[model samples]
Target: MAPKEEVWNPSVETVTPVITLSFYFYPTSTTGVVIQREGFAFSYSEEFEQSEWVAYSLSSLDFSNRNFNRPFFIEDPKVKSRSADWRNYKKSGYDKGHLCPAGDRKSSYKAFEETFYTSNISPQLHEFNDGVWNRLEQKVRYWAKKYDGLYVVTGGVLSDNLKSIGEENVAVPNYFYKILMTKDGKKMIGFLVPHEDSEKALYEFVMDVNTIEKMTGIDFFPKLPDAVENKMEKSNDYKEWSF
Candidate 1:
């Protein structure tokens, strides 16, 4: 199950890091390159035609409480491999899933629009996209509102020789992972959800950062002092985030 062909790139263009993150937290990738965007930073796996991870911060102020007209998904000119055509998703019976969800950027129209970039999306099962996955996103918003702010990194779990869709060969991941931590890094929680729809409580999917790193091979908060990173990554309690 060899990954698809991708040229080696040591780096990609610059974008600002979230408050809890520094350049050091950026995941290591040779085939998957990093790109910073208005609201998030992600490593693009051209091999899978999707992002390996997308990281961002959500603040109470990030929500304007305005109705935003959703926009069309468009190709990201910034992506050198060129982002997948939105057409690949047409009639594919999958949602053009967002890595950086548009709702999180409702603070500004432009911010919301920026999320429409194709590079920010992947194929997702419709039931999953609108079901438990959607509920998890809402929980993130609630946590951000409660704690004032949070740093989050999320993406699908990629494996070799996976199934793909459309003419572009976009990969469909079996599972998705999201890690949430407070601004001061007091508490951290992680979740792994199957790509298909599920009725189980979100808490059922809770995991430790250690497990996510092991599964994805991406160091989450490397910029934290070694001691702090070690302690935080080792904790897996979801009760601290009780809503």
Candidate 2:
């Protein structure tokens, strides 16, 4: 967690546009600070010292395009309160989990590097982060490849009186959720996994998006036609989504 001794090189790529996602799903009015980095968008939570949710779109082409080395984690100076330091995870039995995963943004070095910012991280149990959580992230990439493109929204369930760590009192969520959908809204699925390790099939954690919305208190895809949104959110069609 020591500061880098060498000069850090920032990417020259232009910042990514904030135009792709529909306003219906962003919740900018009620959500905390909204920032659009190279590969993803996020609603950061000052109270929890991490993002409440991170949203990004993945395309099939990104899978094969490029790769880069991971840089040292850095505090997100853009965060008004200043992000938690990486040193907080030392001997903490938790991993500094990336909300907008680096793998999803490998299309550009800048995109990949932005993910290392501290504001995008939350404390996660080592077993859970490496196990089912990792598997689900891989699945999202697979779906991105199959669908050509997909929209993903992921985050931990933050709430009152959670166990905390570090001087920041970073909240440790007992459960985390991920919701994904094809760009056209023809197909969608949601998964809610407890913040613990398990060896079960991924679908075992699948639930309707409505269930997820209720559980998280954040409206997802509010811009879609109500009829389409209602139906998609209410249905958990596992058969339609290939593993």
Candidate 3:
């Protein structure tokens, strides 16, 4: 039998210690229903009708130039509360933006297809999705190739006051964030970008993980040692990231 998965509580430590397939870099949950897929894992937010955060491991070997047919977005079967429907984005003037980008999972057809699950998507403006966000995704790929591998955690800053769309009322976030760390946890960087298109350099959006933690109430990389986590999360310096 599979090890029992722990349901984390944001208020206090309320989980049993059990080793699971989840990566050590996975973030803590604010909401419930943590879903682990073949390619990634995420915490589903029933209130917002989307994932609170998505995380996965990336490496040069994970990238393939193979062309695969794009799959239609569908509700994830693993979500106990049921993920939002893909139609929630249709005619809503927002794109069903991917949290675990399909490009990153192209090495395998199943991995790529898993990214289309609605649980791994968020409502995003088309321009923003195709513009700066796409640029950042490409940058992440480049860094993964350069660094050998990285652990990436990303998602929108979901809140109650944000605009909602479609019959399900999927919340559209005002900002999005991505945090990356080397496999050895020696280098870390975070970016917080406004939910819009801009020609600004990516480095200009750099932020510290500590600030993001406070905003999202998600404890990132909780498995790391306290001293290392504190030092890495407090630094916003991007000089080591090579832009």
Best by lDDT: 3
Identify the leading candidate in terms of TM-score.
3
**CA lDDT of each prediction against the hidden true structure:** 0.80, 0.79, 0.86
- Stronger candidate by lDDT (2 vs 3): 3
Q: Estimate each model's TM-score.
A: 0.88, 0.88, 0.91
> What local lDDT does model 3 show for residue 220?
85
Model 2: CA > 4 A from native: 1-30
lDDT of 3 by residue, 36-57 (tens): 7778889999999999899888
Sort by TM-score, top down from the best: 3, 1, 2
Candidate with the larger lDDT of 1 and 2:
1
For candidate 1, the per-residue lDDT at 69 reads 89
Model 2: per-residue lDDT, tens digit, 57-90? Answer: 7776555557588899989987877888888877
**Residue-wise C-alpha lDDT for candidate 1, range 1-243, written one tens digit per residue:** 833433222133122333223344456653557887667778888888888888888877666788988888998888898878899898988999998788888777877887898888888999999999999999998999898678888899988887888898999899999998776667788899989889999999998889989888888876666777788788777777875
The TM-score that candidate 2 achieves is 0.88
Worst 10 residues of 2 by lDDT: 6-15
